[model samples]
Target: MPWWSWILIWVALVALSLLLYVFLGIRLFRQFMATLKDLGAAGKKMGHISPLEQAQTRPEAGRPLPGSAVFASPTVMRHDYEASKSSRREQRRLKRVQRKTDRGQPQALGDLDFT
Candidate 1:
């Protein structure tokens, strides 16, 4: 092939590369915006569920909220308070269990706790 032919091929390759770059850049920008919109929607959903609403439905299922019915004086709703307390106690128990497991279950030293 002539030198001019090789130069023309090089020019075509460079143009193709630039076109691909621009196409990919625009595609990625649109994808990023879509992801951000989804994240915003997720945040809005979380915000829609206030502590009061959560407590009214299933207080025991979530972390206790400050000044919730669970913690009110005399505990008008004993079941709610008990449920919250049980959840908290279960969390603490799970933490202790995890600690024991992570610590490799203590070695038995003459009747010491084996786990």
Candidate 2:
């Protein structure tokens, strides 16, 4: 083939590839938009129902429904809170002691002489 013919063929192939790319991109964008619309509709439907109503409708095997207390009694909850508070206080005290000990120790690597 002549040089000009070869150039023309190359140009036609590039244009065809560009058109194919744009067509596929538009098709994918439409599909994504449709999916987004479906998700929005589903979200709106979910929003219309109250959480309590939804919880009451669904049956869970092992778990309690929405607002029922997990603990047996108020005293149990209070005892749990008090235990957690004491544990946290002890952790803070230990960390304070650790920090003081760490500050008193020398951390310099220069003190060791390498011959």
> Can you write out model 2's per-residue Cα lDDT over 1-115, one digit (the tens) per residue?
7899999999999999999999999999999999999999999988888877776686667444555566468886677678879888868766766675678964334333255
Candidate 1: tens digits of C-alpha lDDT, residues 1-89: 88999999999999999999999999999999999999999999898778777656744555555566545766557767788798888
TM-score, per-candidate, Cα-based: 0.43, 0.46
Candidate 1 TM-score, true structure as reference: 0.43
Clash tally for model 1:
0
Query: lDDT of candidate 2?
Result: 0.77
After superposition, the stretches of candidate 1 with alpha carbons farther than 4 Å from their true spots are 50-115
lDDT of 1 at 44: 95
